[model samples]
Target: MGKLGLVKARHLVSRTGMGAEWATIQRYKNLTMNDAVAHTLSYVDYTLPRPPRTSSWTKTVGNRKSVSRQRNMMRMSKNEGAALQTWWANHMLTTKTPFLERMTLFWSNHFPSTIAGTKQPSALYHQNVMLRKNALGNYGNMLMAVSKDPAMLIYLDGYSNIKDDPNENFAREVLELFTMGGTVYYSENDIKNAARAFTGWSIDDRTGKFINRPEQHDTGVKTFMGKRGNFNGDDILKILLQHPRTAETIAEKMWKEFINTSRPNPGYTRKWAHIFRTSNYDIKTLLTAVLTSDVFWHPANMGGLIKSPVELAIGTMRTLPYRLRKNNLAHNLSLMGQSLFAQPSVKGWDGGESWISTQSLMRRSGLMTNLTRGNLRGKHDPLFMRHMPECSDEELMAWLIPVKPLHPLPTQPGRQRLVRALVLDPAYQVS
Candidate 1:
């Protein structure tokens, strides 16, 4: 309702963006909550650095077909995938629109296509662009675009689907994961019918784009969701979009994403779903409802969510002057279980408390330790200190730690020392 002061501003920025950036928080601290949310949704940088070099689809497919060249293809994919990961990691660290990147990451996980799965980094690069472009736009449009994305077609075996033999992998995931959220709402017959409807959808071998093979398509009438018609892939997507559970699935996911890890309140999710559906599945509309909702600003919900590896590592770098000793951030992220573009499965990372296993906690602590190792000494780095906001210790504490420090603050007085202690504190792992 009122101005989002330092505390509320940090909560909003840290949760939405990569981290609670000091300059952004400072600017947002002066604006009303509604204005701040609007600014976040409106501001975005679409420019991306030059993409890493990757083999063309034709070359990749040819190499895979040859026994001698298969190993070479694997090597090429491994090398190119690493480069792709670094490119995105670097962008996340330096992007002006971290929230856009965050939403892109969210959708990437939601509709995952992997380097190993596709073995086509070029296709994956284009897929990343598509996801970011529609990250805050229409969910329906994004779903349609992703369904036709070459990387998804290859990764999910949609490219191999034919009328004579319909591979139901894509259809099953669409029903169970993407649109409906689970198997309860749909039947095996529904999945089979959906797969039949999508028979002709495939990637072009030479140009690596979506193409429909009409002769290979199942043109006969198919009964899907109790509606009989001569349906195609687009028709199947339209039917799912019209389903109420599609909106509810996204709304529930938003609850876990922005709100907390606990089971979503159905009442709140239903209300948000209504807003999302009424707005024709506009992502910004759903985000507005989520951000302005009372639950988002509730005192009990503060620090309720654990930071993912990206948030913990890149967020620390963005928030403070700490930098990784090595330039292997992408590798470090993979080690910490949030590898870019390489989700563990179609379900992606389980996130939340699952991020804090004994092994991962050690790695997370090690990362924080290494990043802040330079500031452990009693004295402060003048360069780092100069970059810090000109604020008192209390304000610094509020800005750095979302909740009260779980560990006691260092009694000694240097600002850098205080920062190091707060960052390493257990409380900093959440929010």
Candidate 2:
């Protein structure tokens, strides 16, 4: 078997563990690749920790945001977002189901929406629930769930859609960004039809629940993608899945993440697209196929992806033992440009090289410097056990990435300095 422990640490875990956690992977050294993959998926069945519900933030029974409530909502939502990020970091650091968490994060960006823009924390929390619930389960079910998600309804202006005036924001994005992937694959006519198909699709303002208003719905025929008949949001999704281009778009997206590169290998992507279509969008089936595929382990695609802020931070927390307060951890990440649910736009953060700019890199290093020193606690804060001077530079890199290295780390230091350097290195910045 290939290095099951190494592959698990690199692709699945947010940050590979050290000490006892590391030992557990080594203990499975003899596990076949198939067995190890099965082990990873089985972990997804484990129960995850739940954060406080955002719906409970208010005392009033109705969904109205009173003047005082609005003021509190503005202030408290920031902390709520931070706490959620902290919970995510803790799960990545400690859970056996890191692959599932990783998938949850992937879907979060793939269906990009932000709590800051929604102005309703409860909706955002539930949207996250929707993503996690179907992270590796089924893309079609996930699509249906997100199409009716409260946070998504607010973010995409689905609440504004009505029989009298169809709002095209959500429909346009669903086609351009979510399914077809670009304008070339669809036309403006398709967008209008899709929007009309979702008329009266809105959320309950008080409870942040999805509700279909029959009176507001246009129960007439919608010519979506040239197919004519009375159709609604669910029907549109089913129709969209029938298009071969939609399957190709999803496969290409997943391939980018799996292979760690922006460039598409058409031959390999088409293969996965076939699997996705034939499997009826079974997410776990496609992912399992990709992970077991030879392309995933190719040297050209390994260790080159730039780490998003969440990955950079969570990886650190996993490798080292630190009990950082969730709020502070969230604040630090915000400064680095990724604030959990507060994405800057509906398109989500531009990953890859976009994650690194001159300013952001400095900020990233600064964050690393703070974590290395004891900013997590007080001055001279105790975190690590001792120096790992005996660990070769090659070995250290192996802990963070899947590829064999071109060279060893030039700088050698005590355990603390090694960590600081690793965290700051351009190599460590990537997956």
Candidate 3:
């Protein structure tokens, strides 16, 4: 393949997946950009398992009587909550539908919570399933679903909200991080009023399901974002979704994530924001446009982002063909400064230059060493095949990096040699 096909392939792969492995990079190598985009869109989350309409906790909560049951459930070796994290990591590594997994991960960051905080495996699993279901669907619907999500209610302390003592935690994050760009768009009064609107929006103690206690709901007129009514949680959600900055804020963040730029261009950001609003906040619509846009294909975009920990770990496994032990995943990722399900705070990972640090870099290198030698406890030892087909230096370099190698390796370089060198190289740190 020519340089253009390879460059375009890397651009698409980097923007859309955990890593730009050969299997993924090869699919787009010969196809036209339009066909390639269609290929990407074809791989939705429809085939992945759909979660039940309500989690078991939603069905069971009642009071302190069930506390012992909850504790015993957590003690079980076959905890579904712990299992959910492994399932996700394995799926992302093996997936051909990389965008579906990528978007799921993105939205998880956008609406972040830890299973540690939720304290219920079913709630965590169900919330992730809901996120996947609406990953590329309607943002408005997703926001509403999240508002009623038991896991979210627990994580943000929404479960404690009541008429007399409304919790502002969830309401504040809804405006500052989730909907509007930042505190600049909303006021202290707005947050307080929004909290009132969400009062009585809480999960049942025994069922672990969301229940709006009307008796606890503040039905008195409350002004929120300049709109006055006896607004409730859903009503305030609608208001935020319709706000002028909602689309713009999400578009800009999405741009930063996929485009690898510090900030979006003025004219293009405005145009994308309009497209976002006009689509009524359809996630797939905005994403598809960005993927197919000239902005995405710019030469400056390729391999520019420092790969996040998940991207590096999963991408390596996918590209290299390895079977990592489930137990080691979280520990390894956490050591590398990206815990699988436990983000340090609601702001998410603060990814960027923060991804690189002396300790983390050393840990990453150690990981590569373990991977290269099959030294890890996983069954997929001898990670690289001992023998491989001979190839020109150019082709091998292209597989490892999007660009032609400035310093070429020997023709027929040993497979392990190439694998080790590539992973340790500075280039491998970028997507």
Query: Distance (Å) between predicted and true CA of 291, model 1?
Result: 0.5
For model 2, what is the C-alpha lDDT against the true structure? 0.71
Can you write out model 2's per-residue Cα lDDT over 1-431, one digit (the tens) per residue? 66555555444333222121344455544565576566666666446678755545234223344664666666566666656766655666666656677778788988977867776666676787779889978898899999998778878999889989999999999998788889997789989988988999887655657899889988988788878999988999998999988888888887767667577788988888889999999987787777778777565656656777777776566555544555576666777887778777877776777878898889888777766664222224343544232355565556644454334543544555555555556666766
lDDT of each: 0.92, 0.71, 0.75
Candidate 1 lDDT over 270-386, as tens digits, reads: 999999999999999999999989999997888989999999989988999877745589989999999998999999888999999999999999888888876755444678877
Clashes of 1: 0
The whole-model C-alpha lDDT of candidate 1 against the native structure comes to 0.92
How displaced is residue 183 in candidate 2, in Å?
A: 1.0
Clashing pairs in 2: 63-206
Instruction: Score residue 43 of candidate 3 by CA lDDT.
Output: 75
Regions of model 3 farther than 4 Å from truth: 1-4, 47-81, 323-326, 374-391, 403-412
Each candidate: RMSD: 1.0, 4.1, 4.2
Residue 21, candidate 1: alpha-carbon lDDT: 93
Q: Local error of candidate 3 at 214, Å?
A: 1.3
lDDT of 3 by residue, 232-338 (tens): 99999999988878888788887778777476675766778788889998987887778778877877777667788888888777666554565677567778997
Kindly report which residue stretches of model 1 are placed more than 4 angstroms away from their true locations once superposed.
377-380
TM-score of each: 0.98, 0.86, 0.87
